[model samples]
Target: MEATKRLDATEQALMLITELSMKHGALMFYQAGGCCEGTQPQCFEKSSFYLRTGDVCIGTIYEFEFWLDKDLFDYWKHMHFTLDVTEGIGAGGFSLETPLGKTFIIKYRLFSELELQNLEAVRINEI
Candidate 1:
């Protein structure tokens, strides 16, 4: 069986990613588990967010890595995530898309048994 990628993005999210990358140079996304960002996916210039040891990178979009907090990854390891964009600002948060009148969100579903077995391995952050 072929590997099933653990993450993906919507068409709108892809278009926005291109725009952000053009302006920001390199981009990365963090699935905000809680706190200030309130579970939204937050986009940042790759250099801005510090990757702590053990953070998990599930996949990428247009060469931009999408990461999750270690604890969050542990909690959702069995699920699949699809990144999406919507027409609103993220409340009190500073994701790059917020200023553009968009908010990044995650739509999730449980993986099938076969898909779970075929899932691409997640990488542990070392940078």
Candidate 2:
């Protein structure tokens, strides 16, 4: 059976990503577990942010990597994540989309039993 993807993106989010990528060259996403960002997804130029040990590349959107903190991955690994966009700046104002008056967010749903069984394996420290 083909493996199921752990992540996806909304149309609006994709459009925003395209815009950001064109402006920033390449992009990457990191879901901050709980810090000054308060558990929000942050977008940065691929080389701008540092990936910590054991961070998981859960999936990609528009050829851009989407990462989760190792602890966050362990907690949400059974769920499917949908990348989304919303108006207004996020709490941290550190993501690429912040200056554009939008913020990337995550909408998630639990994976089905079959999906869990066939879910794609995540990459560790691959960023």
Candidate 3:
């Protein structure tokens, strides 16, 4: 059986990624650790932000890696994360898209038993 992808993005997110890339060159996504808005995925210009040694790269969008803190990954590994966007200034506004009045949010659903068996591989410190 073909493996099920662990990540996805909405149409709005895809279009917004294009717009952000035009100005930022290359981009990446990270689900920052903390409460409130910090939990939202933050988009950054590739090479601008550093990926720590144990960070987990759950998947990618348009060649950009979607990363998370390892501790965070343990709690979310059983779910699929769909990247979405909404209007508003995200907390502290660190994401590249935040300045454009957008916040990258995740829509999640638990993996089905069958899907869990065929889910794509996840990596740590590897792209």
Provide the overall lDDT of each model, using Cα atoms, as 2-decimal numbers.
0.87, 0.87, 0.87
Models 1 onward score TM values of 0.93, 0.93, 0.93
| Model 1 poorest 10 in a row by lDDT | 31-40
Model 3 steric clash total:
0
- Across 15-114, the per-residue lDDT of candidate 2 in tens digits comes to 9999988899999999866656656788999978888889989999978899988877778888899999999874775788988888888898999988
lDDT agreement of model 2 with the native: 0.87
Candidate with better TM-score, 1 vs 2: 1
**Per-residue lDDT tens digits of candidate 3, residues 48-68?**
778777888888999999998
Clashing residue pairs, candidate 1? none
How well does candidate 1 match the true structure in TM-score terms? 0.93
Query: Cα deviation of 3 in candidate 3 (Å)?
Result: 0.7
In model 3, where is the ten-residue run with the lowest total lDDT? 90-99
Backbone clash numbers for all candidates listed = 0, 0, 0
Pairs that collide, model 2: none
After superposition, candidate 2 runs with Cα above 4 Å error: none
